[model samples]
Target: MIDNQLGIRKPRGLTAALSILTTYTPGGGRVPYEDEVGSDGLLRYKFQGNPQHYTNAGLRAAFREGVPLIWFFGIQQGVYLPFFPVWIVGVEAEQSQVAVALDEAQRSLPIGGVSSEIERRYSLGITRRRLHQPVFRQRVIQAYESACAMCRLRHRSLLDAAHIIPDRDTRGVPAIANGVSLCKIHHAAYDENILGIRPDYVVEVRADILREIDGPMLKHGLQELHHHALALPRRRADQPDPVLLEERYDRFRTAS
Candidate 1:
C-alpha cells in the first residue's frame, strides 16, 4: 500500500477523519494485505500494518461516525466498477481488519461475523447477484465492444451481458467466457428461450417464433438473425465457452 498507489485512501484535512475511498482488483497483481468480499457478502479490509497508523485511524473514525466510502473495483487497466456508499460497520483489532458492507442490509448484519455457512450464504445470495451482475456486465460488454452479439446494436444503454449458463446453474460463473453481450431485447429473449446461440457461433430463432407473424422487430431484429453468425470477442480467452453455449442451446432446443 505504501509503494503501490491503490488501496485505502483517506482524504487529508477532514473534520471527523475518514478514508473516503478504497480499491480492489480481482486477481490483479498481489498486495501486502488483500481486501476481499467473500460469499458471506462481507468485505474484510485490512488496515495498515500499524494499528496506530493515520489511515487506520481514519478507517476507525469512518466506522465510528457511520460514514460510507467508495470501493473502486478494477475490471481492467484504467477500467473500474465503482461501488459506492459502502459502510464500515466494524473494526477487528486482532486482524487489523475493518468489516465493510456494500449495502444497507449488509450493514445491518452481524458484522463481527456470520458463523453458519448455510445461513451466511442464504443471506448473501441476493447480495452476491448484486455484486456479480455489474462486474459481469462490464466485463462482457467490454469484450463484445458494447454491441449485441446478434444485431450488433451499439447503444450502451441498450446492451446487457446475458449469461450463457445462468447464475443459478452449477456451471455458471461471472467469468467473461460464460457471458455474451446482447441488447436488452435479445437478453430477455435468450433468457426466455425465444432465441439461442449455438456453440458454432450461430444465432437461432425458435422455430415457432420464426413461423409467427409479428412486427418489424420480430422480423428485422430477431428473425433476420436466424442462422447468422454470433458476434464474438477478438480475444480468444473472452470467447464464449463452447460447452456452456451448447448446454444453454439444448434448453432452447427443447423449449422450441
Candidate 2:
C-alpha cells in the first residue's frame, strides 16, 4: 500500500523494489556487492562504486536473495537520476550466486539504446515473479490507460489488466499485447471463458450464457459487448497482441 505522490499505490513489494532499483541504478542497470545487516533489522548493502554503481549492485544482491528493494528516481530537464534509500532486505552470502549469474546475463545482452543489455536484463530479473502484483497491475493499467477496455470505465481502482495468456503458463513474462484492461466483472467474465475477444477486436459472448435468459440485464449486457472494440493504449507499443487474441478466440469460435 505504498503511495507515490502521483497517487498510484505501490501494487506489490517487488514493484517497489524494482522502482527503487531502477531509480538508483541510472540507465536501469544492476551490479553485485557485499551485504550487511543494520541495527534497524533491515539489511544494509555496501555498493562497490559511486552511489549509482553501488545502488545497481545492491539491487542485484536483493534479487539474488529473492527479495525486493525500494528506492527512488527522478527525471529533470530530460536527465534521469536515482537515489537509494537506506532500507534493505537481508540475505546470506550463499544467495550471491544468483546476483553473479544475473551479472553475467546482463553482460551478454545487446549493448545499445534504451533496449541495451543492461536495461533488458534488469527488467527481466525484476519481472520474473508471476505473483508480482505491481508489475502485473502496471502492465494492465498501461495497456488500457487505467480504463476498462470493454466498458470504457474510467475508475482506476476498479480496472484490472487481464492477461489473455495465463501468467502461470509462463512466469514473469511480459508483453503489452498480452493484456486487456477490464473491470472486475469483465475480467471475471473473461477468465471463466464466458467472454472472449476476437482477433478483429470484437467481443464475443458464449452461446450457453446467452441462452441462460437470466434477465434483460444479462441479455443487454452480453449482447452490447458483441462486436464492440476494446479501448486500447495510446502508445502503439502497448496495443494488445493480435496473435494472442487470435489464439484464444479462434479455438472458442470453432467450439461454439
Clash statistics: count for each candidate = 0, 5
RMSD of each: 4.1, 12.0
What lDDT does candidate 1 reach at residue 154? 99
TM-score of 2: 0.56
Per-model TM against the reference: 0.80, 0.56
lDDT (Cα, tens digit) per residue for candidate 1, span 1-256: 1213635677668523333333333322342113265545676777767888777788898889897777665555566677777788888898778877877877766654554776477546745566667877887898788899888899999999999999777567677888999999999999999999899989999998899898998899889989999989988878998988899899999998
The segments of candidate 1 whose C-alpha lies over 4 angstroms from its true place after superposition are 1-4, 14-36, 46-57, 92-96, 112-126
CA lDDT, every model vs. true structure? 0.75, 0.51
Model 1 weakest 10-residue run by lDDT: 26-35
Report residue 78 deviation for candidate 1 (angstroms): 0.8
Per-residue lDDT for 160 in model 2? Answer: 82
Which candidate tops TM-score?
1
